[model samples]
Target: MNEQLQSITGVILAGGQSRRMGRNKATLTVQQQSLLEIMLNKLRSVFQHVVLSGSQAAAYHTGLPVIDDFFPGCGPLAGIHAALKLCAGRGVFVIGCDMPLVPPELIRYICNCSNFDLVVPRVGDYLEPLCAFYHRSCLPFIEQALNQGRYKITSFFPRVRARYLTAEEISRFAPPDRAFFNINTPADWDRFCALYPDLKA
Candidate 1:
């Protein structure tokens, strides 16, 4: 791990309702390890302080510091807010739990570009807000967006200094399609399994 990355905390956002999957995606297995476990390990390898932003139940399972949304039901923005508060000045690498294949190298790359308030990947036209880096300075802008009922993650982007990782840069870490693949539904999980059958072992 780079010395700079060691100062940043890793936050796993596991607060999603999982309506499409009809089950807690955190517990879903890949290679006999839960998705939460895989993500936790990946983040742990790079960050000294790793925490989960989700329900108390998840905390019990993972045995890490868990934080609930300060603004419940407001979507991922709430999770981001709570994580920023928890870190208390340290930068955070926030990622969704369902994205089992998010390469750690990509995460390191984003963290390396931490000169901005937000360092997010711009894969093609989509901004991958979930798999991004947020500095403590972004809390106020994020709170302003939340108070105005703007729940979109990118809603506060304009108010802050943001950096977007280009598709070509992300491609060096992993293929565009596979880099941000998240398990949203049963079919998505099945597809992931088919693509990586060795995960079952």
Candidate 2:
């Protein structure tokens, strides 16, 4: 673990309704580990303080602190807002529960570059906001967006200082597609299983 990452908190956003998968994606199993477990282990390796957003603290038995959405039904932005509040003064690395294969190396890179209010990855033209870094200072802007009923995570991007990792930079850690791959449906899970049979779903 990098010493610099000690001041950072890791947050796993597990509040999604999973309408597409028709099940709680966080509990979905890959190999013998649940998606939540996989992300928890990965984040615990680098961050000293790791928490779950949108899960009941007692639900997992892992002892990690769990925080529910402060603004429920507001999408991931609310989760991000809650995580920022939990982080307090420390920076936070936020990743969705369905993004099971997010590379630690990539996380390290993002944290290393998190000098601004936000540090996000750009794969081609799209931004992977879920697997990104946020500073506590972003709280105000995020709160404003939520209060205005703006749910898109990028709704407040223009109002903050943000750093974006280019495709060339991401390739050094993992393939672009695999790095940000998130399972939202049965077919997506099948695709992941086919790609990594040893870690079959």
Task: Flag clash pairs in model 1.
Answer: none
Error of 2 at 9 (Å): 0.3
TM-score of decoy 1:
0.94
CA RMSD (A), model 2: 1.8
Which stretches of candidate 1 lie above 4 Å from their native place? 56-60, 199-201
Q: Tell me the deviation in Å of residue 115 in model 2.
A: 0.8
The runs of at least 3 residues in candidate 2 whose Cα sits more than 4 Å from the true structure, single-residue gaps closed, are 55-58
lDDT (Cα, tens digit) per residue for candidate 2, span 1-201: 666598789988877789999987888887788888999988988788898887443476778788888898888899899989867546789999888777888898999887899999998789999999999889999999999999999999999999999999999988888888889999998898889756512
lDDT, candidate 1, 1-201, per-residue tens: 677697789999987888999988888987788888889888987788898896643644777888888899998999999999878545899999888777888888899899899999987779999999999999999889899999999999988999999999999988877888889999999999999766421
RMSD of each: 1.9, 1.8
Least well predicted 10-residue stretch by lDDT in candidate 1: 54-63
